[model samples]
Target: MTILLFGITKDIVGQPTLSLSHSEAQGLHTAGELKEFLKDNYPDMKKLSSLAVAVNSEYAQDEHAIKEEDEIAIIPPVSGG
Candidate 1:
């Protein structure tokens, strides 16, 4: 699976996207689990004020199941004036 990163997430991850294998995301069946996986891999992610998970271009709830081929993105908070 590939996860797109935006804003601060991109900065922290040092890349626009991340590629992970099914084994890397093992046991991550839901959006919530995905968050935990990310936090575990990237501790800096937990410092973000907020992070939203999007699947297939739509905001996903914690219960949203993550499929191997689904498009996932980490949308961090944006601030502008």
Candidate 2:
């Protein structure tokens, strides 16, 4: 699975895109699992005030199911004065 990163999320991950191997992709069954994986791999991601996940281009809740063929995106919190 390929995960697109946006805003601070891209900066936190230090990449615009993240690719999961077929085996890894199969291991992640839900958006929440994906988030945990990211946090484990990239601890900085856990520092964000809030994280939003988009699956198949639509915002997904933790319970949202995910699949290897699905499109995913990570969106971090934003703040402006």
Candidate 3:
């Protein structure tokens, strides 16, 4: 599974994308699980107030199921004046 990062998420991750081998993605059945996995690996991600997970280019709730072939993205909070 590959997760695209945007905005501050990219900065925190220090990369534009995170690639997970099939074995690494095996237990991540839901969006929430994926989020937790990210936080565990990249603790800095936990500092963000909010995070959005997109699956197949669509916003996904915690319950949203994810597949190894699905496209996922991490979108951090945005603020503008």
Candidate 4:
């Protein structure tokens, strides 16, 4: 899948994205599992809240079903000070 990953996600994954493996490809193997995947891989993000996500340009939830051919992205929490 092509994930339009952004924010710290890039740092965690070490890249924007390419092809992910099934071992960590949450929804790719079964149902929606973005939250689980993040918590497992990106433990630091566990504290992040009120974050929004978009799948293929549409707002989505952690449990939102993911397709192998879908494009996903995490809408980071914007900060300005």
Q: What are the models' TM-scores?
A: 0.92, 0.93, 0.94, 0.71
Put the candidates in lDDT order, highest first. 3, 2, 1, 4
Distance (Å) between predicted and true CA of 66, model 1?
0.7
lDDT of 4 by residue, 23-77 (tens): 5564453223665566577787677766576887888866677777677776667
Error of 3 at 39 (Å): 0.4
Model 4 spans > 4 angstroms off: 26-32
Ranking of predictions according to TM-score: 3, 2, 1, 4
lDDT of candidate 3 over 1-81, digit per residue (tens): 999999888988899999999899998999999999999998998888789999998999999999999999999878876
Q: Report the Cα RMSD per candidate.
A: 1.1, 1.1, 1.0, 2.8
Give the best candidate by lDDT: 3
lDDT per residue as tens, model 1, 1-81: 899999988988899999998797666899989998888889998887678999999999889999888999999879887
TM value for model 3: 0.94
Clashing pairs in 4: none
For residue 32, model 3's alpha carbon misses the true position, in angstroms, by: 0.3
For candidate 4, the lDDT comes to 0.66
lDDT of 2 by residue, 3-63 (tens): 9999887988888999999998888999999999999999988887689999988999999
Better of 2 and 4 by lDDT: 2
Task: Output candidate 4 Cα RMSD.
Answer: 2.8
Q: Which model is ahead, 2 or 4, in terms of TM-score?
A: 2
